[model samples]
Target chain A: MMREIDADKVAETISGLLQEGCYRLSDDVIHALKLAHEREESPPARHVLGKLLENAEVAARDKVPLCQDTGMAVVFLELGQDVHIVGGDLYKAVQEGTRRATTQGYLRKSVVDRPFSARINTEDNTPAVVHTTIVPGEKLKITALSKGFGSENMSKIAMLPPAKGRSGVIDFVVACVDEAGANPCPPVIVGVGIGGTVEKCMLLAKEALLRRVGDPHPDAEIAELESEILKRINDLGIGAMGYGGRITALAVHVEVFPTHIASLPVAVNLQCHSVRHREAVL
Target chain B: MKNNMPIARAITLPLSDEVLKTLHTGDELLLTGVMYVGRDAAHKRMIETLEAGEALPVDLKGQVIYFMGPTPARPGKAVGSAGPTSSYRMDTYSPRLIAAGLKGMIGKGMRSGVVKKSMKKYKAVYLGAIGGAGALISRSIKKVDVVAYEDLGTEALRRIEVRDFPVTVVNDIYGGDLYQEGRSQYRIADLRR
Candidate 1:
């Protein structure tokens, strides 16, 4: 049975999700931060964490953005195979949704055109980066991530030789965090993707961020890897707001996929404490 | 539990020469009074205007520049969610501005060696706003108005009035750097070897 969804409704749903996502942070991240506050030893680190908690409260109550960067709108769509859209094209509707979110919600329009020359602002913040995957269900799921560039700018990817093996992956991930230092807003959530093609691995890293902060991966080995990486990251002492402390990472999320025998690719995506993402089903 | 921590010193801006010398990296501050806001795009334009031998849009002497661009103001509010962006992107343009008598900068992230040298030479300090705490920071911003480059939208240069704006000194004229000091103090000996 085809589930006919009105495109206008899709736009409205997306707009609503983006607004709520920017204003109120999800419960999981907030909970993780609370845990992080207790774990930190440095006074400055603890102080910064307290301020972040307060900021989260202020953002929700006032309906103001959590960050001024407001970030590029990265939309993820899980479309049911049996769904049919009426009245508007899917991608166009997504763009319309972002436009409405920017203008109506008073969100910052951060998109621009022409990178090489004449970087003109796309004032409407249109053309959300829509990633669609067809699924078995008759219902569609929409997610919006307000991807702040401060952390996005620090993300790194590498195509490692298979011989470099497990230690190399661990080393690479750890070093990335160390080098990112105070830049990507420390006490960050580290997302790791292993064993796939380069682009696929990068995508997986971003997908890993959707997991609740510090939730273990289903695979026991991967879960162990996540814990080990988290331990080492905190040892770097790039604490809350990079003021240095015992909890540099609130969590480490690792996702892995099978790959060709000769290839081992890895990607790291860092999510600053802002960590804004929201989703709705329709 | 909070007894050991130093209280944040309140500052009224248009920072005077005497005030500049007293600030140290890691000292918490709550800023009041006015500052100008700019970022990558606005800084580039100001440098361009100056390079062309044209008059600059706003005065720099004894002024602070915040590396920020805010969300649109809500109903009856001056601005929305004003927070600092990364400062490194402004590194290329900062020395020139500092040389022009700018007193301070507010933003997050570490700055460049050149920018640090310029700060030492020009007697300027770098302050860091809490990254990702825009809504909390916005509460302190009482008013905002675009003073130049309105076409740039959020990146437009603006003059703002603030009360108890929160910041920590990351770089000071006396060669203190909080990021460096903070990291070393807490870094545990490598447990992985």
Candidate 2:
């Protein structure tokens, strides 16, 4: 017999996650920042990192957002095939959760109605960028991430010919960070997605960031690549807030998928040190 | 060689040429006094108003403009998390504002070459605030009022009074750029050599 879960429960869980994600820096991310601060050689970069740590502490204590750009909510849902959602439309329920969280949490309403023409504020930060997948278990997993555009604006995607392979991927990812320079805010967390189709590659890259900081991919080869890419990025000397330092990037997370023989799509997604994300299961 | 330890300076707004000349790229500053808040939309509207030969909402003569769009304040708070936005978006309009006697700007990221040249030409300074440190930064703001374009919501023009608001000199009137100088200092190529 399949299990039934109340949509209200999901909504409430999402609301809490949204509020928590914005106010608190995840433990792993905080740890990474502290490590970066200690390792940073540039005094300015060290000072900036110290300020960021202090800011996080203030936001947590005061129950306020860590940054003014509380960011667009990006929700990742993993639903079980055996579970049935009851009492409300799934999408509407999630949107309502986001609305409630933004309002009750006193977070900023940053969503605009139209891209180019009308350009009106949505007021409640609604219509979250939601990605859903169906899986085997009876439990539903939800991860909420507040993605600030400063780093999102710096993301890049390129479809490389298969022959270019690993070197091509390395060069592209490094160049993206170099070009981004100070704009995305550093020390940054880089998410690299390799293989898959173009859109899938981009999603993979974003999802890669959901991994806890300092955790490496299970695959040895991929983990090695992650370390290499991370070292190269830090070597760029973009530093904290681009003030220059030894530790520009705290970590580089990579996600891979099988791809067609003709194509090797690579996407690089950068996250500022704020790195706000939280997860809940119901 | 520039010292690794950032030299701390205290500055007040409506900056003077003598004060501007003394600032160097990479110096840390505790800024105090009033500043106008404006972003891309506000800049565009201001520029349009200028082209129409109409008076700007806020006078540009000897004042600092902070590039930010703050979150709405909670009931008891002066303002919500208010932090600097990227300044490059204002590249087109800034030179005109500098020409109109704007003395300083607070924002993150780099400015265009034209904007830098104009800052040097007009004796203006560009200050950088920590990008994601909004909540902490907001604590420095003691007062806020919507000066113009309330309809713009978060993008509305705001007049805010701050005390010891933290920032760093990213671009100075002497053609110095902290982003370039700082990064070049730690680049792997140079460090290896």
Question: Which lDDT tens digits does candidate 1 get at residues A1-282?
Answer: 898999999999989888888998889888988998887778888998988889899999989998887888899999999999999999999989999999999999898999678989999887788889999978899988878899999999999889998889999999999998888987799999997888889999999988888789999999999998898888887788877688889999999998888888989999998887888999
> What is the clash tally of candidate 2?
0
Model 2: residues with Cα > 4 Å off, grouped in runs: B1-4, B190-193
Q: Candidate 1: where are CA atoms >4 Å away? A: B1-3
What's the residue-level lDDT of B192 in candidate 1? 57
Share of the reference A-B contacts seen in candidate 2: 0.67
**Each model: TM-score of chain B?**
0.96, 0.95
Give the distance in Å from residue B122's predicted Cα in candidate 2 to where it truly belongs.
1.1
Q: What's the C-alpha lDDT at position A216 in model 2?
A: 99
C-alpha local distance difference test of each model:
0.90, 0.90
- Could you give candidate 2's per-residue lDDT for residues B1-193 as a string of tens digits? 2546666778888688788888888888998899999998889899999999999988979999999988778889899888888888899999999999899999998889999999999889999999999989999999999999998888888899999999999998889999999899898872422
For candidate 1, write residues B1-193 as lDDT tens digits: 1324568999999899999999988888999999999999999999998889887899989999999999999999888988889899999999999998999999988899999999999899999999888888888999898999999999999999999998998999988888888888888888556
Per-chain TM-score (chain B), model 1 = 0.96
